[model samples]
Every structure is written in structure tokens, then in C-alpha cells.
Target: MASSNSLLSEMQFLCPICLDVFTRPVSTPCGHNFCMSCITCYWNDTPVCQCPICKETFEKRPDLKVNTFISELASQFMSLQVTDAHIWSADQQKASCGGAVLCDICTNTKQEAVKSCLECQTSYCDVHLEPHHRATGLKRHTLVDPLASLENMICKEHTRLLMLFCKNDQVLLCDVCAISRHVNHDVISMQQAYKEMKALLGDTEAKVQQMIQERLQKVQAMNESVKQSVTETKDVIANGVQDLTTLVSEIQKSQKELVKVMEEKQKEAEEQADEFISGMKQEITELQKTMMKLRELKQTEDQLCFLQSFPNSSLLPHTMDLSTFSFNRHAEIQHIRKSLSKSVSELKMLLNKMNTEIQKFSDDTDVSNNTMLRYMQQFEVDIVLDPDTAHPLLTLSDDGKQVKYSMGSGLWGIQNLNPNMFTEHLAVLGQRGFSSCRFYFEVFVGGKTEWCLGVATASVQRRGALVRGPGCGLWAIWFLEDKFETFSSPNVPVHFGKPERIGVFVDYNGGQIYFYDRQTATLIYCFTECFFTEELYPYFNPCDNEYGSNLDPLIIVPVSRME
Candidate 1:
């Protein structure tokens, strides 16, 4: 059976083209066997139809088909090969031993060692190790994990195991060395020395871990600082661009107005000169007509005619003396020219002094606070709380401008049946919704240890626990656990001093939300590139009243303009 199996395992089942066991064994007309795919691929690559092994040619490419008999035999041969692979023998077992240390006592088929004896200086397999466990004499010897070489553990000079530790020299010593050269040294057992060194190493490891933690914290701090610096720098550049652009526009406008003023002055002077010239031309024409009449009378057979036509002196026009008729062309615009000259000189002085003004603008930390707040104040709206949207345990003031978390039932024991009312969270929305380009409002959070303020879309979820963020139609910041953070995915912490009043400003068209410390006019944070498709209402939450720490009401105070 073995001989027959060996003969079947020969190259008879292999494909002549692929030189391996046939996958889908096929036969050609010339009686040659090959893998079906290999023959097909080979035929497709070459123009001529021929067999790869025999080089036999065919007139037309014959349709190749898998040979079931050869294919079944190939399949049986593959199975036989797999079966033989699992039959492990002693030689295979020896090869499988890998690089482990083998028993020194076993002459044939050595087994892997489990332990090494210090006294015998030899490694032993589990079977051979049984003697040391049973024998009283060998039981006294020390056994350790197998070592490739036991020479290192023995003292070179004493030819004995180093079993003691000398503290003075900080070295391992043998039994003979302990009483010889190391006799005067501070000696102790090796186990005790190991315990002490391990304890010291643990302390060093703890210190290293603490240093790593400190450095990690410092890295986080530096990263945060870099982020803050980048944000501030971008803000500064944007503000500088806006300010400089506005300044340039104002300069251009002033220049246009100045040019108009000078042109008007010149036009007035030209009109006055034209009127004087017209009067002088009319006088000259009248004088010439009078002279022509007198000449005709002097030659005259027309003396009677001249006396009849000549003269009612009251009807003749009177001419002014040439010396007294003086027109000062420069006089008409003289005052205007003087004013323009003075203005130009002053403008030059201002241009030269612009360095200080620019420096002041750069040094002004509160410039944005004042400028932005003052502009945003123009769009300020009076925000009043909506009782319809107030949570069940929330109380609204009579003026609808303040809200607080109620300890017991709602205010006046009136249950709100409104569909828009919040059923879970201690929150309320503004009575009026804003849909304009921009809006501003302020909320006084004084004496309150916990609060939330911002704007929410009109379609915000009110019946259940509301998730906070743009995705939930809410863009807000809150103070909780004595820390300020935005209600974003992985909430971002805001580093700023607490303010009594928070000013919320929204630029709907620009998709931005800004929170300001109203007291100091400081910009606390801004949410940029937000999407506001629908009307938004002011959102407020005064936290719970269970803890006396947050009993203060959140008031919607009127915005005060800052100049």
C-alpha cells in the first residue's frame, strides 16, 4: 500500500504547463494533461494554437474540456498528500523542538529543559528534574529557570556560586570571598539585597512616571496656548483689515467733498466775471450808436432831423469812468483759496502724525470690545421669556424678562398644556423669535452659580431631554461645576473670568454667534460658520433649585450701548 501510494504521489497528477498538481485537469487531443486555466491563458497569449509541453499543432483551436477521470485522480492525489503531511514521525518531532535548551543526560531524542541546578551546574528536563525533587541530598541544591551558561553565576577565582551581596563594594560575592577579601565589607544575604534594590527601583520608576505626567500636562498647556495665539492673531488681522479699509474709505470721501467745494468756488467766480463783461459790452454798443447819429447830423442837410431824434438827455445811458471800473479776478475766490491752503497744510500735518494714531490702535486691547459692542447695540432687541415654552418646574417673572427654577410645582400651580413647553430640562425660550440679519441681547446672570445662555432654532426639541449643539438646533455656552464651556460635541472649555452679564450677539446672514462680557466689553467666545435657516429664539436655563447654589434668576436685561 505504501509503495502504491508513493507511486501515485509522483508527477503523474501534475499539470505539464504549470508543473504543479492539476487544479482543473484537462486533456488535449494529443493526450497531454494540463490545468484548464493555464492552457486557456497560454492559448490566448499566442496566435498559433499548440500545446506547451509537446509543441503539437492543431488546425483550429479545439474546445477544451475538463477531463473528469484525470481531475478525480488529481483530487485523490491531493488528498493523499494532505494525509501524509499530518503523519508526524520522530525526525519531525526532533525538528519541532526549536531552539530550547535540551536535557544533557538524554543521549537520544533529548527533551527540553525546565530547570537548572546551581550545585550540579547542569540543566534538566522535567523527567530528569524528578530526581532533584525526590532525592534528599539533591533537594538542598538551588534550582532556577534554565540558563544557557551557569559559569557567570559562579565566582571566577573561588569557583563557587556567588551567594552573598557586599554593600560597601556593591558587588556579588562567593562563600569564600565573604570570609576572605570581603570579610571587612558590609555584607548581607543576596535575597535581602535584591528586595532593597527592587524597592529603590520602584521609587525611581514612580518618580519617572510623575515626570512623564508633568510633561504631558505641560504639552497640553502649550498646545492650548498655541491654539489661543492662533485664534487671537487671526482676529487681530481681520480687525486691522476692517479698520484700515474704513479709514481709506473715509479719506476718499473727504477728498471728494474737498474737490466739490473747490469746484463750486471756481464756478461762482466765473459767473460773476461773465456778468460784468456783458454789462461793459452793452455800454460800448450804445456809445457807438450815439456817435454815428452825431456824425450824420454834422454833415447835415439833416440838422432838423438830428434835433428831432437827438436828445432827451434823460433817455441816454450814463457811462462809468474807466479808472473807477476795476474788477479783481482773484478777489472772488480769495477766501476759498486761503481756506483750502489751510486745510491742505493741516491734512499734511495729520498724515505726518499718523504713526502715533496707528500705534495707539495696535496697543488698544479694548478697541474691538468698544467698536463691536457699539455697532451691535444698534440691533439690540428686548428679550422676554415665553411662558408657553417654559419647563414644568420653571418660574417666569410677571414682566416675562426673568426665569428661575422652581423648587416645588410651577409658578401659581398653573400647569402649562402648551405643546411647546419643555417637559424635562429647566429651560425657557424668548417670546419673540428673531429672523433678521443680526440681533443682540444681554442676560444678567449675577449671583447664579450655574446658568446657560444662547440662541436656539424655533424648531428645537422641547418635550424631552434636549441635546445641545448646532446639530440639535442649539448654539450655546454654559457655566456648570464652576467652569465655562460650550455645548459642543466634546465640549470646549472657555478660559475667562466670570461676568455678571453676558451679551449674546448673532449675525444670521454671516452665520456667527458671539458672546461678550458686558461688564468689561470683552469678547468671551465666538461660534463661527453656523447655519441659521429658521427663526431663532433666545434660550436660557437657570439650572436646578435643588442645590441652593443656583437659586438666582436669569434676567433678560436691556442692552446698554458702549461707545
Candidate 2:
């Protein structure tokens, strides 16, 4: 029966190519072995090389990496000296005799010392050794037994037998080795080669394991850096978005002013054209009527006899009066002409001023906001500017009343546009607060609703509102369909009572408007966050336009029959 070591030796240690031992060996995908450089040289010469085991053609040679650990293990196993198990057992029983010398032939175990000679196959006490040496001067008597003698044998070029042990040769070579091919090369006996290689095995294994462990740690560190880079990419995109929003606000403001200037100037120009055209039309109509009457008098029967009697002198005077015509222009027309000219000149001047103002706003579009809220961005939001250690973000207000019309905290929520489309929100930062608490706002877009997250947020102020401020929380509304409740309080910003003010407008955009606590800039729970602004009824519009009376958010929910 083959031992496990012998089976493993055949499986992993032996290289199929060469077969003597694995030397600089490498394994293929088909589990066949070849020397590293041997395979590369083979494939480089041959365009496609087929694997020996599977006959699978490989288009390219893989990288040549050393399998040094397994190769070293193979070399160590080939050099050991050992014995047959059954012979060792029999020898052990014979060696038990007292005063008998143990054979130095096979095993490393102990027995009584005996003077043993292998050629005679005789074991003798040290006193009996003198008789055999004097007889015939025997030449073939090996002093040592078979086990130790096996190490001394060498190969000869002529006989090629295990004989002629070479003292200078280091390796067991065939009889051909001592020919001219090895004329000057130094060599030693087979015993010397085995001794040297066996001693180096322990040190080789330690070095291989240390190298593999170090490389694996390097691969792991590289993967962690890849994950960190993904986080940084997200931060850059979020900052870009905030910058775009600010730019859009400035653009809308400049556009509104431009439209106002153009409309005023256009109206004045049209008025001037209409007044000049109307007076010219009246004079042209009167001249046509006078020419028609003169034709009637010349053709009439009553005037025909008088025309014949008057002769050439009367006809000349009539024709003369017809050719010459004039009128005194009223001061009203003159005054209108002067007034219209002045109006146009003023309109042109206003247009020039507007163009300059627009350029100023456009140039400031890239204004940078360094004051950012630092925090890890949640799923809904994109950018988080949270520092390692900063005070908890204050989203709440003290007394939780940031919506007190124009009275409390000096916060007057004014619309920048007609519908307040372009508006800014301010928040009174709250104190140390729980993470779950959030802000609420009521919107009135045709009806009452809420603002979306991130779309509505606190003002730029980071400090908690201990003193009177913009009250920290501001929800700008168009109040187009609805209106703002008009009322004021001295220090308290929020209207504590029922929503009763001049205009009651709800923020309605399907969004969340966070009215933070002014004291610490932290969001208040249920006290100040309002969702439905329609609760403040009897709403009055803020704009002074005649159509302001039509302030009613048109809300309609048409229902279908349920199946």
C-alpha cells in the first residue's frame, strides 16, 4: 500500500514534464505542469500552444509568477534516508541481547554495542575481531552495514552502477558524468548533496508565508480607498446645485425690472402715435366736405343763370378761395405734442438706467456662500457640510413663533415676486434637540399645502435667535390666489391665536416648510410647524392691484365612482 506522503508526492510534487523533479514549475488551467520559462519560450515560437492534459489551445501566455513554496517542499522530501517497516521490527527484537552492539545499519534506536561486519554477515564482540582481518586480507568487507553504506555509493561513466564512490563529486551522477563533460567541474558524493539540501528546508517555508500575508493586506487597503472616493464625488455635485439655485434667483429679479422698464416706454410711444394720427384724420375729412358743396353750387339750376351773368370775374374769385385754405391750431394739440415728446425722452432715460441695473445683478450671479450647514446628507437631500464637531444644527425658534406677521422679532415675510416665486426662507435656530424633530410650513398655491424638503429650509443664519431677528424662520408665498394674515406682536414672532391677519396665506407646494425655533435654530416639534394655511380664513391679498379682490386659491378635487 502506498503511503499518503508518496501519493501526495506523485500528485503535487512531481512535474509531469521532465518527471525527475519539479524545477521552476508552473501549472496550467488544465492542471498540467511545465517549467515557467520553458512554457513561455514554447508559446512565443508557436503562435498557439495546446495544453498537454486537455489539448485546449491558448492564444496568449499568462504572466510567469514563481511557485517557490511548493517547489522547495518537493526538494526536501527527495533527500531523506529511511528503512522498510517490517525489517526494522525484526531488527529491534534481535538487538535486545545484553552486551550486543547495535547495528548502525538501519534505524536510529538503541541496542547493545557489537562489532558488526556486513561482508561476513557476522556479529562479534570487540575481542573476536582480530581473527578475520589476518585471513586472506579480504578486500570487499564493508565495515558499515547497508543503511550507512547506501550513502557512500556513486555512479560511474563506464559501468553506471552504484559503485566507485567519488570523494570529489557532490551529486549522484551517471557513469557519463566523469567524462570530458565534467572534466574540471567540482563534484561530491551523493551523501553530501542530500545533507546540504535537507538542512535548508525550515528557513525556506517561513519566508514564503510572510511574503503572501503582506501582499493580501495591500489589496484590502486599495478597496477601502475606492469606497471613500465615491463619497467625495457626491459632495461636489451637491455644491454645484446650491450655486445654480442662487444664480436663478438673481436672474429672475433682473428680468422683472427689465420688463417693467420696456412696458412703460412702449406705452408712451403708442400714445404719441395715436394723438398725431387723430388730428390729421379730422382735417382731411373737413376738406373733402367743402369740395363737395362747391361742386353742387356750380351745377345747381338757381346758380346756373347767375354764373352766366357774372362772367369770368366772379369765377376767378371762387376758384381763388378754393385753392387757398388755412386754420389756427388749438393750444391743446400743441400742449399734447410737447407733453408726448417729454414723456418719450424720460422713458428712454429710464430704459438706460434699467440696462445698467441688470448688468450689475448678472455680474453678481456667482456670489459664493461659504456659510454652509455641515451634516451627512440624507436620502432626500444631496449636500451635507457637516464638520466633525459643530453644534447641532438649530432649526427651531424660541417661543416657536416665526410667523408673527410683521410685528414680532422684526421679521416681515415679504414676497419678492408677484406669486413670491423668488423668495428666501429664514429659520430661528433651535437649542439641543432630538434628531427626528422637523419643521413645518403651510403653503397656499391655489390652495393650502406644504413645501417639499430641501426646497424649503432655514435662513442662512447659524446662530440661535435669542434677540429679535428675521425670527430665523421665513416661508415666502405668492399669496396670489390667497393672502397673508395681517397682524403683529411686540417680541413674539408667531401669531399665537387663530390664523387671523389681513391676509391668511398657506404655503401649498406639497413641501415641508420648517419653522425652526429661533432660540437655537433647531426645529420645533408640533408647536410652530404649520401645514395647512387655509385655516387662517378671511384672507386679504397683499398686492394693491384691482384684481387683488380675486384672491381665492382655486382648489378642486374631482372624485370618480369607486369600483
Q: What TM-score does prediction 1 earn? A: 0.40
* TM-scores for candidates 1 onward, in order: 0.40, 0.23
Give me the runs in candidate 1 sitting further than 4 Å from their true place: 1-99, 102-112, 116-122, 125-135, 140-384, 392-420, 423-425, 431-441, 446-450, 455-496, 505-514, 521-537, 543-563
Question: Among all windows of ten consecutive residues in candidate 2, which has the lowest summed lDDT?
Answer: 368-377
Instruction: Kindly state the number of residue pairs that clash in model 1.
Output: 0
lDDT of 2 by residue, 410-433 (tens): 332232222211122222112221
lDDT against the true structure, per candidate, is 0.81, 0.39
User: On residues 303-409, what C-alpha lDDT tens digit does candidate 1 reach at each position?
Assistant: 67767876677545687567976667577568767887898799778777776555645677797567778878888988878889888778887889888877655
Q: Which candidate leads the pack in lDDT?
A: 1
**RMSD in Å for all candidates:** 20.7, 28.6
